[model samples]
Target: MWYNIDFYIWAVNLLVIRLRKPKMIAFVKSLVTPIVNIHYDFLQKKAIDEFILNHNGQVCYLRKALNDVFDNELRRIRIGSGNQYNRQYIYTRAEQKPVYLGKIYIRDKSAFADTGIDYIVYVPKKILASRELELIKWIEIFNEAGTAYKIIGE
Candidate 1:
């Protein structure tokens, strides 16, 4: 009876081992590995994407950071238009047209040349008075080395 009981216990252990789902564990691992790898790849590439070199070989990650920062903290400020030359709209009264005099003219100086400045941070009048120096220092700290920037109030 003791030998019979020991044999039965061994058989039960073998059956339990056979019942264990190794395939299911492998399937779960297969399903999860790609997801984990994709997230890891994205994190790695995100760090790379944040850094970029300018024409002068200076690291200009601030261009990307500035976009994010401006979008979040400085809603009233915007980067100037044009990649080659910065552009801005000016409101002025027409000097030659008396019939249209006193009426505000929105002028676009399309012939403007690049001013050798790298980045133009345009701030609305109200914010510029209060934060000009702060914005300048922020740009100085983050902008590419030796790059010039202007803070214009609109």
Candidate 2:
């Protein structure tokens, strides 16, 4: 009876450890990277503020732009879920279709190929286009909605 109890305890402990691993990893990842750290406060603030103002504080524009450019591709890739971390948002479109978006770190190339972000909008080009002004306005709306944004480049 004692031996059975000991084995049961050990099994329970192992199960607990296993269940905690993913949460621990996610926590560690969050701590290692400062989500809001900005090297140039002024620049970051201005960019963020401008984006908010330009977008008139709407988050839908980002989704719209993404859908417009990559909805079909996402469907093709079969990535149908998304994970959010700070200012970074990842979308996986793997339900009936397959498309993965955002910074995906996959160990297997085949898996990546099977499910990857179909379309990527070039920031600079989007910024330079005639529609830039409109895009900025939309981004500003998102800001007003209290959404944090991360500018990839200076």
Candidate 3:
């Protein structure tokens, strides 16, 4: 009968709509994902910048520690173009020439710490063995204060 055919058509249409509803929603969500990601990235960058700004003062302390001259104003200068490694300071004592030493990398503790980075000193390739224990001890002090450090080099 006509009524039975109409009912079948109506049921099929309802079934099709029910099946397609979630797929349509997923497609729309996929389209919005890029925009959501951009916003998330923007917010993350802002938070990181704020965190860096707040914690950059630790750099001076790090410089003083690395230079082993707490009293002297640290004159740490970036070594290469990128921030992977940098000379924390030049220790020029008594008759010694300005050594191209005191290099260090105060890298990010994690990509997620809010203070930008905790006490994790990445050791450079050329630190003197004599200074290694001292450096480790110094880093240990910070590490004990809930800031962990590691010695990584080539």
Candidate 4:
């Protein structure tokens, strides 16, 4: 009787092991491993391509040049508001006052014009001259605008 009981227990364990799905384990491992390299690379490339398409490829070149100057400042700035409607940023100036900037709309009247888009940059009156100058320098370096300008609104 003891021998029969031991055999039954062993058979139950073997059955449970056999019933486990190998494909489920494989599916989970597949989701985790490629996430590091493959998914990240694809996302980075997609972002670059999208930026190029929206800004006529100027955003790519501008990003490199702007990084040299205002990369630190840019890091400090925060996107202020807007959902699917507009993109906005709020930056605290060197004097510790906040400025809000954003893109509004775009329209073209010329027949040959590319109705790309238009944008807006807003600066609060409380911002200091030094911070304003730094922001303007970045805008000039990037061939962008200050207080008001037009670009593709993404």
Candidate 5:
């Protein structure tokens, strides 16, 4: 009889342990989740920092990023004729003036030299009114070093 009771107690203990195992595992996972998230956030931040450092002052990258920023918007603005009905903006390349470099004069001066803005971005006045701040922030983030640009409402 005692042996039977001991066996029942052992079996019950084993059952309880088996049931508790999953709870223990879940508790451990809960504790680990925040740490994993912190590590992942740190790694993501580090990657962005590295990219900014390595991206340097490349105009091509800045231009491409700017184009992508507009394209990625939910409303899908485009670069084309700034028709009042169209959701679009126009980008004009820097106008360079002739500077004597060698046999031929190099066009180095921007057409509008009075302003520090190197590129002129014209947006539909209505769209610009609504999105000016947002567009300006994205432009600043992706601007090339020693280069500046202005966004005008057309």
Candidate 6:
């Protein structure tokens, strides 16, 4: 009788596993891979405009060569988990994958709040709805705001 009961339980477990959907795994795989084809000329123009406006129309070292801004800052620094504050809005996603993933941290200003200076702008295995929109917003912020970033888990 005990052997029969054990077999019954095993059969039920197998059925459940087979019936389970694979949405979660699909989401993870998508996040793990990102599309890297795109143009940045428009963004470069926007970044330059933003810098000049923010700096009172002054062309400083970085402002003069704004195209280098993304290459210099975005590819540098370090990516954070965005878990320091346990904020739910920080998790990110890509609409059609991304060129990269990482966090953005302020280059200057010592002792700034961790959350304020570092934003988990991009990552794989994103959660929460509307994360796609959030990712786009944060990437723009990281690129245009003069913040530096680096990949952590990648």
How does candidate 4 fare on TM-score? 0.23
Error of 2 at 67 (Å): 4.8
TM-score of each: 0.35, 0.21, 0.28, 0.23, 0.46, 0.16
Estimate the overall C-alpha local distance difference test score of candidate 6. 0.39
Candidate 6: count the clashes: 1
Question: Which stretches in model 3 have alpha-carbon errors above 4 Å?
Answer: 1-20, 58-122, 126-154
lDDT of 4 by residue, 1-154 (tens): 2312333234334544655466654554455565445656766887756644444224445544434334435432222211124333355577565564445354243211233333333333333233667655555544544322332212
Model 1: CA > 4 A from native: 1-74, 81-114
lDDT of every predicted structure (CA atoms): 0.53, 0.39, 0.47, 0.42, 0.53, 0.39
Clashing pairs in 4: none
Per-residue alpha-carbon lDDT of model 3 for 8-66, expressed as tens digits?
A: 23433555455656666566556666766676677788775654344322545454455
Q: Roughly what TM-score does model 1 have, to 2 decimal places?
A: 0.35
What are the per-residue Cα lDDT tens digits for candidate 1 across 108-147? 4432445555556766776567766766665666666666
Alpha-carbon lDDT of model 5: 0.53
RMSD of each: 16.9, 26.1, 19.5, 20.8, 16.0, 25.9
Error of 6 at 4 (Å): 72
RMSD of 6: 25.9
Q: How accurate locally is residue 24 in candidate 1, as Cα lDDT from 0 to 100? A: 51
Rank the models by TM-score, top first.
5, 1, 3, 4, 2, 6
Best by TM-score: 5
Error of 3 at 115 (Å): 33
In model 6, where is the ten-residue run with the lowest total lDDT? 57-66
Return the lDDT, model 4, position 83: 16
Worst lDDT window (10 residues) for model 1?
Answer: 51-60
